[model samples]
Target chain A: MRKAIAASAAVIMLSIGAIAGAAEVKMVGTVQKIEMQGGAATVTLKDTKSGNEVKVTVKDDLTLDKFKDKRIVDGDEVRVKYDDGDGVVTIFRKTAGC
Target chain B: MTKILFTGLVAGAVMASAAFAKDHPGREYMEKNGYKGPETCEVCHPGKAKEFLSTVHWTHASKVDNVENTDPAREYGMKNRIYTMCNGNDIVNNLKEIPKTPDAKGTKFSGCNTCHPGNHLSDVGSAGPEAEAAIDCLVCHSREYDHSKRKPFKDDQGRVVLGQDRSVKAALAIAKPTVKNCMTCHEAAGGGVLVKRGFAFTKENDVHAAKGMVCVDCHKAKNHKIPTGFDPNNWAHDGVRVACADCHTETPHKDAEYNRHTARIACQTCHVTRTGGSFAKDFTTWEKLSNGYYEPTTLRKDANETVPVYAWYDKTVANRPDFIGPKGSRSDKASRIYPFKVFQGKGFFDRKTGELLAMDFAPPMSNGDTLAGVASAAKILGIKQYDPVPGWQTVLFGSNHLVTKKNALTCNNCHAPNGVLRFKDLGYSDDEVKRLTSPELYLQKMAEKQREEW
Candidate 1:
């Protein structure tokens, strides 16, 4: 009997916790342009589905061997996840990459 | 056998001498000054040392007009006491050190007690004959004396006994000194200067001052204490230290927080410094640092700190295109949430009307570090997916006074779950802007163009 009561209580607490956590959701904005030599870039399609404007970020990717002029440019939209403005973005496919 | 008798006599002599030292000065001084006696007070009251110290009774005598009456000069020697009675410096040093005492303008220090009597500091330990006691409480409430103590009734056998004990009498028998304590000093007739200013001092009939409150209620203790010294004193006999907060909890903030922020921020945090002006006049200005953020300048006693002063950062807000405003708005003005906020991140107001909506928010800024964190959290909470409104600081901060009968800073402004959290009489709403204004009124008008377009 005690085991059954304990199990029931645990389930109730978990349900309440889950309900409270469902209120807010988080997402990140995409980076558009990367000024390679200057270490900054202007990007479009920022966070929030409602935003039409893009954001800018500095790039420090070591793997990109073509360092000179290969950084991102204006109008280049990329899928990025920002955790407090820091995170990795797997560029699914660089489209309209200038 | 002779040695035994001598030892007993010596012990008795030693104990008596110690007792004499413990209870002599107050009694001797009273007797020399023709005081009735300390026994007169002890007759009407018993076991009141605790309560007496807690009240104005113990301190009242120290404020008597003739400082010599309360603080009779004592001789501690050439280095210490030249000629004195009680330690007046202890009482004088505790009050504010104003440039001049109100009544005694050329004088450096004087308080309300300069008119009243019985504030003798040494009387706390007064002991001795009957006459001295009558002069103490008798000067004010002389009617309480039953006279039964003086003429001891003898039995028919001719043996006498102590008369009606004054020590057992109730505190109410003293009549509470109505005409003397509050009214006498407040009227300026009793010699306190016009501290209240413009208001008819006598018209109020001591309504605010009568209820055990004194001039020190509004005046700073250091500025009002007798000798004009800022030395901290312990008011609580049980060891609780008296401080600015002992009386100033009337406003939304606490004294500890006031002392902490007084240097870094402006003094108008909880007070109405100006005669009649927007809240911004008191809290105007925020400096926008080159790092795409705004910071408040530290206030100085001599001058107002300039706001929106750019440090010419190598990496100023010039690079951030996302900062929304007019196309060519100066980064200095556009970046910071100037006109600083008193509530930090704990209050909210109507985005339009400069009227306060709600205050009494949670987690009082424990310190500057915690304040920064609260500001950051408010920014994140205020952000909407694509909302054009700046962070909460820019949108609502310093815009209105957070008006709530409750704690004056809280999330209730927007989250009033019930509509009760509003100053409807003043036409203010929670989480809504009916009108936005600025300190000079010009910015509010100028900003109107922006608010409308946005």
Candidate 2:
């Protein structure tokens, strides 16, 4: 009975994690350029591993603040988690030691 | 039921984000309504705004009449320092008023006022409550501030001033000044990365910047007055200073012999060996290019491994208002050997009164005429025509960045023959120079001392 309960909990946690993972595409890279238009901003990033450039649009007010104020600029490495479908970043932070 | 649950989950996430807004002293009403202007920030934090208004970041000088400086011919921030860049201060002079003359007809910008929060060629945002609307609080506080979008406009008094994007969302993003916050202005100085200060924080070189230290970490601001050690070639300091020993111990090194050197050696001498990679400008002159636009002629440049000039510096050299470099000698107890990045250039001087030349970025230079600008500046100064006195001299700036333990000097660096230091040049006698250079003799002395200890 205890073994069965443990297996059931494991399955539920895996199911929840899969749902979250499927909705987001995560990456880490250095910023190459950031272009803002109206309320929308597009950031081009040079992938740290693949060495390929990926463009991701950011619409959140908090992330937009970082771009406008130059917190995230060219040559600064950042970690990003974006929507898999629309490629809009949901979480963006600088890859810093602190 | 399933659709209802999904909607509820979305609402919960939204509420969680709203709860994350910084709980601070900002007026609650302004968060809902849009930020009215730069003056509104002062309304919420009246004390902080008052303290910030007194800073060099706001006034450019420690003491001066905000509207007019002691010398009208010179620009507002030219103060008493010698202008070394390209032999003239015009490259950065942000004058308050554009001269009403044909020579200045094409001059749109008073000078390079890009970094200042006030944005105006002069009159930084607000000198008092009257100028508060012109203040750009985000430029120094928010990492997300976009200074390139900051525009110049005419105020109620018809004076041209700089304005910023004063949205409420930008205002709410304020935090302590980060290294990134300072870089929006500092990195852009001298028109390129690491060109002006030759100090950039990177994981490979700087342990402080890499460990996420902001500029305010070392340049600690007390009541908004950041302590900048004086540079004879630049500006004066406030009161306090930024020193390595403030954090590091008097005897930092574990080894007794290495630790003993702390009495006469600055931390920067062994650490900051090179800066501004090979492309960094060592020589700059206002000599016009073939295109006719006034630009600096760069001479010698340095890279990551470039050797720096060495000098004996007094402990208080950085605090002195008149001399950027302190006069020191081997015999001086308060002195230490320091490293300097020696910059060289040429510019004009007044042969009659013997005054160092400083002038506005005259309209002629804006219209791509170099000679006209100099002539216009002379007319403004009410002086006779001038000639380019060979301004060629070693203008030394402290080499205090690009620190790395990887390239730190070994004992042979100073003691070995053909090492980095020149013993005779540093006031050492011939016998002393011989003794300092000869490693065999040094080894013998060490052996004798070791035998005695045993």
Candidate 3:
């Protein structure tokens, strides 16, 4: 229950952080874990370069459907651009496809 | 031609926006400056340029990592490792510096590095912005990149020079590399265009290419270092290796019988059914002609259909220069039945040292001195001067590409009597061969292994 609260707080920060930090950082990372709730989803990504787990919230409808359909599954390497301050991914897509 | 280049330019300009090309944030800056040099790209991507500067693609040599050379002293590429193609006498030794363009005579440019992406070969272990500035970024990033324009020649000043196409259009076209980008250099491998390595991974040859999969789909390059699996003879690099298991898991087949074969057989062994080349340059022998002109006698053995020689191989087979192949036995679990392209050429070899002497006979004769280059290489190898005997150098090239599921080998293809596979030569006993040829026995073994696992 405590873990769920932390995750919920993270999603709120993503919404508020979008306006705080506009400078998006692009990086390639492997998907470690995914947690979905209502219209919001949090993806745990292990950075390819630093090997650090970064929790980023995804609000995009297309990307959310990709997760639901298993098209973007765990262990998939994704090239993402996210707001470092809020932890919301602007661009999230698999690195393996054409 | 002008219209097409203009159309490509206009389209590329639209895509060059910072949002469109996230990787090339400075794409517009490069275009505005007419893509002056590798330095301009550093204005936005200093980190990317810095990461790529010291790579083998740029420096042509790096500290011994995956080289697997027998000589402990073979610590770097090109500088060490006596190459089978040119015997450490190609552009790696000849090219001293980069000039602006290929001279009128086109004498300064040599082979090997000709296929290399870099406009000039940087110093080994070199880093920093100065080295990064010398790198030609468009060659690997732009689909419109034309390698023919980047020619090397000797200027009247007697300095080696290179001609480059650094247009704003080319800069704007820059994006993440595609098959077209990699193939611009990789396609011209071996000898002139459409030779050995070039034949593989084409739209018609490989299934991946047919489905529009690029080299990176399998190669999986990070930063600048691409994973090369236990590089072939003369290929010196120390890095992670790409394996079939990376994509196809250890157990790829539905049936246990086929999956069991993966333990002893390579993915390419059955998939790469034949090697191709319309007029492939085969066995070449050099003759010191009576008129002091050296003549080369080349026999094109296989026109287009060439079967690869299956041999027991592991990653470390290329360290031994005398034996340029995968070194492993059938008994070794690390080894598998891998396909190979055997190269036979007449060259000088030392009988006492068993050192495959550098074949001075040149392709377009880079140095023009037949024995002079050989003698210098011999000195470096610490080979005592003696009567140089005429010897045949058998070099083996790995056949891992040009794959097709359609033409994959069936059981009868190798198991039938007088079959393509020579089981005895491959260290198989007569009884073992008989058992291997029997499909029932192979299935039984697979079932037994699966049962044991359960």
Best by DockQ: 2
Which regions in candidate 2 have their CA more than 4 angstroms from the true location? Answer: A1-98, B1-28, B63-80, B86-92, B95-110, B119-126, B153-159, B230-232, B277-293, B299-305, B315-324, B384-390, B440-454
lDDT of 1 by residue, B1-454 (tens): 4435544544554444334323323343344444333443444455333334333333332322111212333311111110111112222212222232123212122222232233222232233332233234533332233333322233466433223223323122343333332322332321112111112212122223323333323322231132111110111122222322333322323334434543322222222111111112101122322211222221211001111111111111111111111111223332211122211111222344422221101111111132332333344346222212111221111211111122222222212333222223223343232221212423454367569879
Q: In terms of DockQ, which candidate is stronger, 2 or 3?
A: 2
Interface RMSD of each: 38.4, 11.8, 20.0
Report the number of the highest-lDDT candidate. Answer: 3
DockQ of 2: 0.07
- TM-score of B chain for each model? 0.24, 0.77, 0.78
Which digits, one per residue and each the tens of the lDDT, describe model 3 over residues B1-454? Answer: 5436544543443344333345446655665666776776767666777788656666665555333544455445554444344455333244432121222212223444554445543434456666666667887776555444576765787665555667776677677677656755555444323343425455677766675566766676787787766546536553656876766667766666677889998888877777653222211344322212232343322222577788888666555535567777898999888887766555556666666665333332332354554665466557567555556556677777778778787666677566567788899999988876776644555577679989
What lDDT does each candidate get? 0.27, 0.59, 0.60
Docking category for candidate 3? incorrect
**What are the runs in model 1 whose C-alpha is more than 4 Å off?**
A1-98, B1-44, B49-135, B138-173, B177-244, B247-454
Q: Candidate 2's residue-wise lDDT over B88-155, tens digit each?
A: 33233554343443433133333555456665633542466644545677777754455545645567
Q: In model 3, which regions exceed 4 Å deviation? A: A1-98, B1-27, B62-69, B76-79, B90-93, B96-108, B121-128, B155-157, B194-198, B277-304, B318-321, B359-369, B372-387, B439-454
Question: In model 2 chain B, which range of ten residues has the least summed lDDT?
Answer: B277-286
